[model samples]
Target: MTARTVRGAVGATLAAALITGVAACSNPSPGGAADAGGADSAVVGIATEPESLSPLLGYGKDGNSKIFDGLLTHDAEMKLQPALARALPEVSADGRTYTYALRQGVKFSDGAPFSAKDVVFTYRTILDAKTNNASKTELDAVESVEARGEDTVVFTLKYPYAPFAERTVLPIAPEHVAGGQDVNSGDFTTRPVGTGPYLLTGWSKGEKLSFRANPGYWGGEPAVKKFTMAVIKDDDVRLTRLRSGELDAAILPPNLARAFEKDGTRTTFAARTFDYRNVTLPTQHRVTGDLAVRQALDIAVDRGAMVDKLLDGAGKPAYGPVPTGSPWFTAGTERAHDLDRARRILDDAGWKAGEDGIRVKDGVRASFPLWYTSGDKIRQDHALAFASDAKKAGIEIRTEAGTWEVIEPRMKTDAVLAGGGSPADPDFDQYQLLTSSLGGDGFNNMARYDNPTVDRALEDGRRSGDPAARKAAYDTVQRELVKNPGYVFLTHIDHLYVVNDRWEGLGTQVEPHDHGLGSGPWWNVESWKPKQK
Candidate 1:
């Protein structure tokens, strides 16, 4: 999923009532009686500071906002559940409206009573034209939000969006504190007041964020007393801290994480992280724009070897948009590498190979620069490895490390090594990646793909509520997606996390694009307790 949409747009980073306490004594592994989280607390190492704590901003998008909460929340499994809202919405027969009944007696960290007004206000702010949220597109389907009573809030949609429930997963801002203020620039962004189990107590700007358990939390008191996320920008530094017991939990790239398995510093591998890495082929570029060339790249790359060697058996090769666990995954969506077929396809398309082995078509060399974010070692490694393999197929792949600021401007003409996936709805995870309407901005579909079949399938999947129909729609989309590849689909990285064994109740679940601070392994941190001997 993605900001550009995960129905959670990748990290989230949305609607909830699915809040239920894990069995207080159900230790994930064999352990003694653990002290319930009261004054008990620990520090975690994170790579990036949260962009913002404001609900209108990117803070809660990773699905781990310690302060704010919405009517709905998700469980460890990512199923929609109740947090502040009383329960899941009551959908209207027409499917354009969703009405939710607010939970009673719940108060924000600052003691402000939560009401349906808060929900309406939060939704309205997101829909506001002046808001600077990258995910404003996520709320575009909502035509209006109504507070029918003190406890009732209803949403009317512009269309029958099947992922509407998923879209409602945003963290609700406190209408009392955030209602009239200019959320774009305000003190509330940093000093947020929330209704969840934990309250933000301190932010050390680029250093750390600290929180304390909320005594008034409706879900029984949170066991974790003091939660601190230390900001360590470098992976090596973070791991170094992890080994020294400075970090209670840390997310590591596969290559680095593999080493922690035997260190007694416990590691949790969240199996099907919908997150996948792919090479985005900008459709406007002559070398990449041709359908044959896209297909040739797909066949030429050795996805299995990349997973086995680069990822250290921590990932699954991807051929299509959706990851394996999703119901929409098809058998032939990703095929084994066939360099011979790739070569034939290129030659038949009239591309002639030069003396140096790069193909040429219509006076244009079959070569393009692939861009990856500067900091991600995995992306860098993948890019360099891909360049090495593509040479055998007579394709010149130039790998470049650039920041998003520079790469965003040149996405239409340059290739990018991108990653994203969501554990929510199938349409939520892959729709924007192929929609023709989203082609120009290319927020998700950076490759600028506009296949009519894929577009219809995406719209159909979102416009209907029928499970079978949605499945059929996505199946059609995938079948078509494989034939006209937009990205050289790589591997779905297994989210690897290392945590000290001091705490009980640490469990693994599917992860999103955003890691470390949010939904990786700490989503249910409030339920943790010290391992009893």
Candidate 2:
């Protein structure tokens, strides 16, 4: 899904009315709110509003997190743990099929009994061409999903998919409720029912969404009885509301986290390999397609400076799609801001500096539009910083801001800031982004990047049953990708969430990317409790 599509609903509401000034007051002091009686009704705020409640249809992390429960979840270390499913699926001898035994009596928020049927339905719908599910590429290897029994679901794969179990992170939907209807059609996309800890209480299109605790959760009862997710797109407004106590917790830019740290409110930073902000260079674009121009853009970028100055050292310089900390991360890659090298590469490629300071090649100016979602403050800052750096290299980088609707189609011909990541594993993250066939039809491969070597490595990694072999396969892919420069590696950001210090046990994993609010940090909402005096 495009960032615009994800932010459109929230943007419309934010435009309609000014946010009421809420008191910028804490409950009492640090850890004081824990003693308050209504701690059960903890209120959290997210920077962006969710696009859809349905897990299958919602590809963005912001929205899918609220209403869906994946089969497995990752801990702070990226270790897989059971969320909806009882445990990780058992792989067959041939490594082609996976069997998962369901948790005893999980029920959907609607009180419908959740079983193997729901799991079967969720996967089948995604694999079905008619569903037109955004996540269809993730399930391309799955040949079939069948209910072995009332509590067991088995998956037959077309090939030995090493990340098959990790794919369980996709939330399951109730078969009975979602029966006979096209997955992509109708009101279900907006209004979805799932077996997560939270139940969708109310959604006002562009305003806010309210969720109540699902008392029927099989795991345990949640401490937070009611939660409200307001779609506040403006960074200033989101931070303001967070400080004013209008929200118990809020997702803030990395720079703002340090500012809030001085206050009693607790700010927690988790390392993630899941998401990175990269400049997608369209090979078809006249200016960006030139190898020298792409290399110049890469060398001109001061990634370390961007992280230290803009992000307050909360993120690491990205070498490639894989973050530095991930197991599959290839170290010693060639990424550095060398202005001399940039100038040499551009000059050697027949691109002479013109009177306007922009390079000119065959009557074409060395300038292309860099698109970013308008309201995102961090992206805006990154774009400005990137443009400033590129200017020093004699390359003209024109920046544009718009919603995803206007930007998605343009991605085919222009460069844009693409944010993507997943904490599960390498296959879960890389394969979907780089493969040619998976490009136009898949998740967010807007760059239309295609490489035969990368594709071979991806397929080898997927088919390999041995853990060591799979890691090596993915490692090779990362190394090759870094060499090819399909994407200008930017930075792997640490997600910062500022919350009232009253509550404890807010479980969050150091993700490779954001798993949405519901699945990542908020996955264990049922176990969290307000500390007693």
Candidate 3:
């Protein structure tokens, strides 16, 4: 397909919104008047409003965390734990089947009893072609789901997908509430009901969202009384609000989080995350289209310097798609800075350095606009640093911080500073963003990369559950991808948050790209307790 068509198709959805999460929240029971105790409520600042609360949309970008309960949830350490389910899922040794035992007597916020059917409906909706969730690929391994009984839900996967358990960290919506509605644009998209510990009391859109505790929560009453998620897109404004006591907590860039440490306004909570940040080089563009230029761009970046200076050493350089210590991480993928080699590679590829120090090939100057969210200081810093490093390699990188709406159309031709990764494994990490088949879904494969070798290895990894086989397959994928790098990876950021000390239950979270306001600091708000008198 042509470049323009690709951009239009992919940019329409993926860039719009989506992501992973937790479930629960506070007092006055759900929907009761914001009691006189509203002063004790926890207010958080988020960078974006959620695209939708429907689990079909991966619980959205906004982090309305308390309203939905997933079959599985992550602990503060990011390890898999049971939420709606009674306990950890039982996986078949063959790797194709997963069985979850529903927690009996659990009730949705609306008072409906939780059932295995809810689990079945959730997956069925996401897999259905009519469902509009762009992140459906996260569950692509599931071939079928069946409610074997009132308490047991079984999932049959197409393969022994290694990351199947983590993918279950999705909200299980009540069928009685959302069943017949349009799965794509249903009432549940905005108004949600699940077996979570809180109810979504209010959503003002672009302003703030309100929540109250689910009194019938299976886990017992949460200590927090009321919860508010305020949308503050500007990084500085978010910090300012936290200082002024407008918000009890906020996620800040590493530098900003560090600044607040000594301010005494809020205590910084830094957590390790699989949130991988990389610059996608769209192959459709002439400047970035050249494979040699892409490789040189990879070598040109000083990943260590970006980590040290930009992140204030709060992050580690990302070599491949996975974290450094991950079993799937390919050690050979990590490389040291070699600027002379980068320039030589470009020169050998027929790119000639002009008098102005910009590389030119044919009639095209090696220049393209790099896009990022304007409010994200992390991406902005990464972009500026990227441009500086590219200049050294005679490749001009013009950084543009456009709103997602503005950046969507240009995703076809421009490079983008994007962030994503999964709590699952490398499959979740690589499949959506790197695969060629998933290109039209906004953020997935925005780079427009196509390589049959890498594709086959990725397929192999997904199609088998044998550890040895999967390892062999993924190992090949890493090596092949590094040989023709599609992204100039910078650093895997440590998600940082600052919260007030009024409550005692807040804990660190293993965040994903889809972190919502509720998903981070508020993951277990229901468990937070006021310091005892």
Q: Which is the leading candidate under TM-score? A: 3
lDDT of 2 by residue, 1-533 (tens): 23222233343234223222112111222421122235577666665555555565644322236466777865655677787778888889888988888887787877788888888887877666555445566677889889978889888999877777777777777787776554554345555778777776666544466667777777566788876665566667767777777777767777666677677556564535457888888778898877778778887899999899878888888877677776677777748789899899989999999988888989998888999898877787888888889888888888999987677668778788777776666766677777777555423556667778888888888777788888778778877765566678787778877777777787566554544355435555667787776
Name the weakest run of 10 consecutive residues (lDDT summed) in model 2.
18-27
For each candidate, the alpha-carbon lDDT, in order, equals 0.75, 0.70, 0.76
Highest-scoring model, lDDT: 3
TM-score of model 2 vs. true structure: 0.89
Of 1 and 3, the candidate ranking higher by lDDT:
3
The candidate with the higher TM-score, 1 or 3, is 3
Backbone clashes in model 2: 12
Q: Give the TM-score of each candidate.
A: 0.89, 0.89, 0.90
Clashes of each: 30, 12, 9
Where does candidate 2 stray beyond 4 Å? Answer: 1-37, 59-66, 265-273, 441-443, 512-516, 519-521
lDDT of 3 at 422: 62
lDDT of 3 by residue, 1-533 (tens): 01123333342233333211112222322322222224457777877766666776566322235777788877776778887788999988898999999888988887778888888998898777766666677678889999988999999998778878878877888889889776655566777887777778776656667777777788886767677777777888887777766777888888788777676535778777777788988888888888999899888899999999999999899876687867778777787788999999999999999999998999889989999987787888999998999999998888888887788778888988887776567777687767788764566788878888888888888778778988888788778767888777778878888887677877876666666565676777888888665
**Candidate 2 accuracy as lDDT:** 0.70
In model 1, the worst 10-residue window by lDDT is 16-25
Error of 2 at 255 (Å): 2.4
